[model samples]
Target chain A: MSIPRNWRTRQQRYSLKAEVCNTCNKHIFPPRDVCPHCAAEKQSWTNLSGQGEVFSYTTMYNAPAGFEEYAPYTMALVKLAEGPMVTAQLTDVDAQDVKIGMPVEMVTRKLSQEGEEGQILYGYKFRPMLREAA
Target chain B: MRDVVIIGVGQTRVEEHWGKSLRHMAHDAVMAAMKDAGIETADALYVGNMLSGELGGQEHVGALVADFIGLRGIEAMKVEAACASGAAALRVGMFAVASGIHDVVMVCGVEKMTDAVGDEVTSGLATAADQEYEVSQGISFVGLNALLMRRYMHQFDVKHEHFAGFAVNAHKNGANNPNAMFQSPIKAETYLRASMIADPINLMDSSPVCDGAACVILAPADGYRARAKAHILASAVATDSLAIHDRRDPLTLDAVALSSQKAYAQARITPTDVDLFEVHDAFTIMAALSLEAAGFAPRGRGVCMAVDNEIGIEGRLPISTMGGLKSRGHPVGATGVYQIVEVVAQLTGQAGKNQVQGARIGMAQNIGGSGATVITHILGGV
Candidate 1:
């Protein structure tokens, strides 16, 4: 649960991100150091809007002790607008409201803490777009 | 690769083995298969194990099982692919024999999961998924499966009752199995009323983590005999991205579909040709995915098939007559070997009560992680 001191600087993004192979052009989430398709490490970083549709989602009642406060939370596989799918928690909607193809956006929130004082870690979660356009 | 045949199979009942040591339980399971095949010693051994990091605080289980099984001087190694570790061990043993480096090999899968508490077990199993990306966000396996179940329900117009039917059917068959961890039959209505884990998934839809062991002995094709019981027609293994986020569609398991396709091709058989299936049902939603991946039903059609009673014993393809991981008990390492043993039982006409009539051809699908590793095997009567 402890985060490295320079994690924010070294790591690309706290949220899920990936690289699409320049050749085969397949989406690789969490962006691999090398492309598994064409065996090329030559790739670029791209910021995802964190908005996508639910590829699939699940609700879990049985969770770890620290997670009991959020019991029965919905976990979803969100297919990002950029292409690669990301696994994250769905928020601001009931589990029943979350379904395949439902639009969602990412929001940063406190996931869990390791110990005392400044030990809290923040991560991204997806929330369904409930309000319609004006 | 050379032709390989399964000459021996053995398993111990899955439940509270608090009275016995893990190694002792493993030895007993291995010994049964050795005696069944009349094999006194093994040239090489592979053990499928998971969660030793947090469970027993031990690693290197391969040498441990080998030493206790009286194969001290033999080459030994452990194979892991999450829950599919058992099937992965079987694949390694198959390769060991097929490569001509060894004429005979032994594979055993054992898991002592009950050693840890519920929270610890959940955390341990959570490592199977992407730790940094998914788990850090508080996503448990049940939540992941629930999302999949919810999506499948919404997309295919499947009802919560359909899932209950799957659970009820498994329990009915599991009751006939003396070795199943939970042998009592459950009604679909009761299953629906059971405490829910996610909105649609309930406690009944989940597989309990139990402790058990299963073993199998493999030899070259020339070692087969008429009374050998069953022959290994094909064993195919495939792997996909380890992280669930990496998959194109969470509902579709490309690794499983690909491995099953290769296995069926190698065996020259289709899903229709198989008499029964012992596919992994680590979760209730898994049964539906397995059916689709194995080509018994089209994508998104498994729920309908279940509702129509197509996967039942009297239907076109009977599945998990041994209760599956859902009811049979998921011993992690032992699960894949258990599937093989069940197929062997069905093919040899030894499966009583719940057995499919004149069962001859059988298929087993065992997966690791969230479908990162999948191994499919087709076995037939002699």
Candidate 2:
């Protein structure tokens, strides 16, 4: 990602900031300019509590170019408590320990590095909340 | 709208063309198709490509290909919809002829993947997904499908091995296709034990990275009855959220369903009436999802079709009849045109040993991203 592109996306990356559609009472993560469902332009900003459950997950043995360091990493679609799904990595848990309905909380972590001297990209990932562990 | 008939078709085998540049492959396919149509020139040229700019360092493939084919003065441009680039080009060509703006148009789907390294191709493919939210999370395109496969297994109570039927069918049909990248058939055991790229997505489940090109020449049906091979019954495209997570039901391909619905409506035929289907089997999971989304099978029941041996050459609904994206080698953009080309082969009785008996109508569905952009086309005997 370009440095400027990375810098511009900090709001949703850091705080899980989302846009709530005032008309439908639905939340859109990594907020678009307008409501996706109702398209009602009427909107409100909200920072989600980051509570969610895993919808589906995978462990990539062959990661992409810059993400080689994180090969064999686990990723999932977490259904946030706010009623929106977000793509995130499952951290602080073994790939074997991750379950479909596992409850998790969001954490801002380093996603990947552009290069040795490049900026370290950071964004949202999920770790199993303290409620359950094996 | 006037009727648009596919008067000519041409393709290079779906495999690594190490000796051929994109322009070279494009020129070969464009000329072959024009010759098949017995035409001297076309009114326009539309090239379907995705990663030429990033991987080939050439973005304007339409102009590049047109000039290379020695038709420098025609209207030319690239039509891109990620992996669906090929069919997207076909759609543009259809509109050109149907709207009467052009009497004859050429559509080519080309991809030169082997020119770049594996990592570069992988990253370039991910650009098809949502860069801000999806790709930013570092999920590779295969990884995204892996997630879907895992969830599908959990929700439907299916085992990973259940997907073997899809691969087996693709390989079985592909083996008979001389143009397929993988010409050898594989047993179910081979697929069940294939190496995993991402958990739940094994090496056999994913389509290969290769270079190839396919082309079709379209013209109005009024003056082309003698030369026409197949008539375009329908050409429709629909889209959904770029990120799979944004969908109402992640498993449901809304775009696939919508595009297929539109095509079925335009073709005036139900799924049951179709004799064969050329599905985008970039991954086995996608094949099953596409089957369900296109109304071939009920939701969550798609795997049953595979497991029951219902997708073979003579089964209830023949799919991947000409290797498909899996054995056919999905050169991303080129895969779509290959699908249509294969469908034409079937409808015209040109499909050799892999032909579906008395195939009167055929459907081809090409998907981009996870399921964001889907284009469906139906072709019938002229």
Candidate 3:
């Protein structure tokens, strides 16, 4: 990935920054200027709680380009407490133990390194929340 | 608007054509279609392709294929909607003929996926999903479907075995199709024993990656009334959120429902009127979802239709009559036109062994992405 492009969206990648529409009162992850639901332009940036349940998930045995090292990793659609769903990799948990409705918390982690000389990208990944904490 | 009729259809066997370049495959199909139509040239050519740039390092395939076929200077362009590119191009061709702008329009869908390695093709297919959120998370295309399949099983309390019949029936019908990539039949037991690509999504559930090209000639029904194979009863395209998570319900495909409903309205018919349906069975889950979204079955019960053997050619609401994307091989963009070509074959009584008995009306639904872009076309035999 290009350095400029990766740097531009660092806030969302690092902090789980999302947008909330004033009109629709709906939250959108990976912030967009316009609200997809209400078509409203009045939106505010907010940091998500980074805590949610797994809506669905999969263990990706076949990794895509730049993700070969993370083969057999689990990825999930984590439904945040604020109501928006975010797709993220599941860390600190075995794929076999991952199930729907499993509580998870987001944490910043290295996503991938572009090329040998390219930038090392870091993004938020979800890990299973401790049962006692819930 | 003038009514458009499909006069001719041609396609290459869905297989790994390592010797054929994209232009060569397109030329073969276009020439075959033109020969079938008994025409020398067409007013316009619309080529539907997904990844010529990513996989083949080539773009502007419309002009390239048109010139290669010796039909240069006519309005030629490429139409892309991920995997639904073929049907999207066909939709454009339909509009061209209906508007009286082009007398004869050629729509070809071609893809050369086998030229690239497996991981490269996998990465290319992942472009169909959300690049920023979904693919950035290192999920493959099959990984996305695996999540869906797992969720569907949990949500509906369905078993993995329920989805086996779709592949079995597809392979069974494919055995009779000369152009299908996998002509050998598969059993449900084989589906169960197949190695897992992703957890819950076995090797048997996925369509093979291959190269293919399918072409169709559309003209005004006024002149070719007697010889036309099928009339374009209805053509509709609809879209939903590109990312599956954005949908109101992940299990429901709003685009498929909307497109099929729109097509049904335009054709003045209901889903039951369709004798055969060529659905995009890129995955077995996709087949079930498409069936549910297109009104073939209730929500969360699409797999039941497969389990009950209702999708067979001899059964009610025959689906994937000529092998579908499963056994015919999904060459991405080419799959949509292949569906249309197979539908024409059934309509014209050209489908030798895979013909659906008394097929008068047929529907073909080509889906792009998880369920984002859906193009539905309803055809009627003359």
Return the clash pairs for model 2, or none: none
Better candidate number, 1 or 3, judged by lDDT: 3
lDDT of 1 by residue, B1-382 (tens): 8878888888899887887767987898899999998879989989988876668897988888888877898999888888888888998998888899998788998899888888888888877877777777787777667767877888888887877767877888889899899999898778878888766678888888889999988888875664366888989998887777766577788998999999999999877899998978888888898788778788998776664257677777888888888788888878999999899989888889978998888999998877888999999888
lDDT of 1 at B295: 84
Model 2: per-residue lDDT, tens digit, B94-158? 98999999999999999999999978888999999999998889898999999899999999999
Q: Is the docking of candidate 2 incorrect, acceptable, medium or high quality?
A: high
What DockQ, on C-alphas, does every prediction get? 0.61, 0.86, 0.81
Candidate 3: TM-score, chain B only = 0.99
Compute the DockQ of candidate 3. Answer: 0.81
Top-scoring candidate (DockQ): 2
Model 3 misplaced stretches (Cα beyond 4 Å): A131-134
Which residue pairs in candidate 1 collide? A57-B147, A58-B146, A58-B147
Q: Can you give the TM-score per candidate against the true fold?
A: 0.92, 0.98, 0.98
Give the proportion of true interface contacts each model preserves, from 0 to 1.
0.77, 0.87, 0.77
iRMS values for every prediction: 2.2, 0.7, 1.0
Model 2 spans with C-alpha error above 4 angstroms = A131-134, B307-309
lDDT value for candidate 3? 0.91
